[model samples]
Target: LGNQAKAAMNAGDLVSDDLIMGIMAERLKEDDCKAGYLLDGFPRTIPQAEALKVMLAEMGETLDCAVEIDVARDVILDRLTTRRTCSGCGEIYNVKSNPPAVEGKCDKCGEPVVQRDDETEEAISNRLNVYNDQTAPLVGFYKNEGLLLS
Candidate 1:
């Protein structure tokens, strides 16, 4: 799955729906999910949402709600682009909000804190375009299903 995902991402595409649904189906069978689970950044498309409905129905369950964090694209771009991660400790910092004590250095491990390749302005802009084209529709889909919580 990692290889497939990497390939897709490298090609500037989302992972195939089949791969995601298969993983989700198996994951939902886990003991912890029998009660309930909080899924984030999933069901990004209407097809996936429908697949989830079928999957949950097969398990004799139903979705309660879908939460949407409606952030503006400019805000997302600014926030994500400003994020820096420690190479050693994986600590996250934001240049605009919570910069490291020593600029470009991690306080925890003294490692370089750098912006991730995927968090670059170009990369984030491309991701925002993809989200608008593909994932944004899910908001209306969930709303029509009476499952949206914005």
Candidate 2:
């Protein structure tokens, strides 16, 4: 779903709410989610949240709570700025939190670890702007539903 949305996002456009909801609906029906599951990076809008509630209700399930990890934007920016990813193994490392054994190298694959294009400051800022614009409202929406737990 992420890759499906990336092109539009890179063009500074949002993937339509219906498309995101459809992807979520299909993924939720997989065998892994039969016993309930935790959702993150989803339900970005009030409608999406409401639709999710209805969808789960149709399956005789419902969201019990929503968990939010509160982090400062500056901190998030700093963290993303230092992340290094390996193309060979797709392993990730953080310079501050989880540095590799050798500088500029992937410990697992011996490949050069590079910052991904999307992790660049500009790209990260764009993503943050979109999240703040479209997804931040969910904080209030979930709070009103008494499901927001930060």
Candidate 3:
């Protein structure tokens, strides 16, 4: 769903929560998910979380736990601000923490490392704002449902 959302954004289209939910519903019907599956980037919003509950109820399953990885906003900003990617290989590196062996060069192919426009401070802050507005409610919703583990 994250890739779908990213693709939609890159294409200048609105990503519908229903579409993402539909994809999740389809994936849940697969045999592997019948036993169990770890969802990394689904149920991002309260509505999606509720939709998931209904879907799982229909499948005679319930969520066992949900974990939230906590990180400081400043840390996120700092990390994103320094992120650089290789245009040739699409390999990502961090200037401050994990820079390539040669400055501004890709370690894999010696190609120039460039900062992705989306990784800029302004773009990152905008994305973070959207995340806070839309995705934050799932934390409380899951907590109320006793599904949140941390």
Best by lDDT: 1
For candidate 1, write residues 1-150 as lDDT tens digits: 657777888898868988888888878888998778899888888899999999889988998999888898889999999999999999999999999999999999999999999999999999899899989999889899999898
Model 1 segments more than 4 A misplaced: 1-13
What C-alpha RMSD separates each model from the true structure? Answer: 2.1, 2.7, 2.5
TM-score of each: 0.89, 0.83, 0.86
Give the alpha carbon lDDT tens digit for every residue of 94-138 in model 3: 998899999999999998999999899999999889889988888
* Better by TM-score, candidate 3 or 2: 3
Residue runs of model 3 more than 4 Å from their true location after superposition: 1-7
lDDT of each: 0.90, 0.87, 0.88
* Collision count for each candidate, in order: 0, 0, 0
lDDT of 2 by residue, 51-146 (tens): 898888897887889887888889889999999999789999999999999998999989999999989999999988988897888888889989
**What is the C-alpha RMSD, rounded to one decimal, of candidate 2?**
2.7
Report residue 41 deviation for candidate 3 (angstroms).
2.5
Better of 1 and 2 by TM-score: 1
Best by TM-score: 1
Which window of 10 residues has the lowest lDDT sum in candidate 1? 1-10
Q: How accurate is candidate 1 locally (lDDT)?
A: 0.90
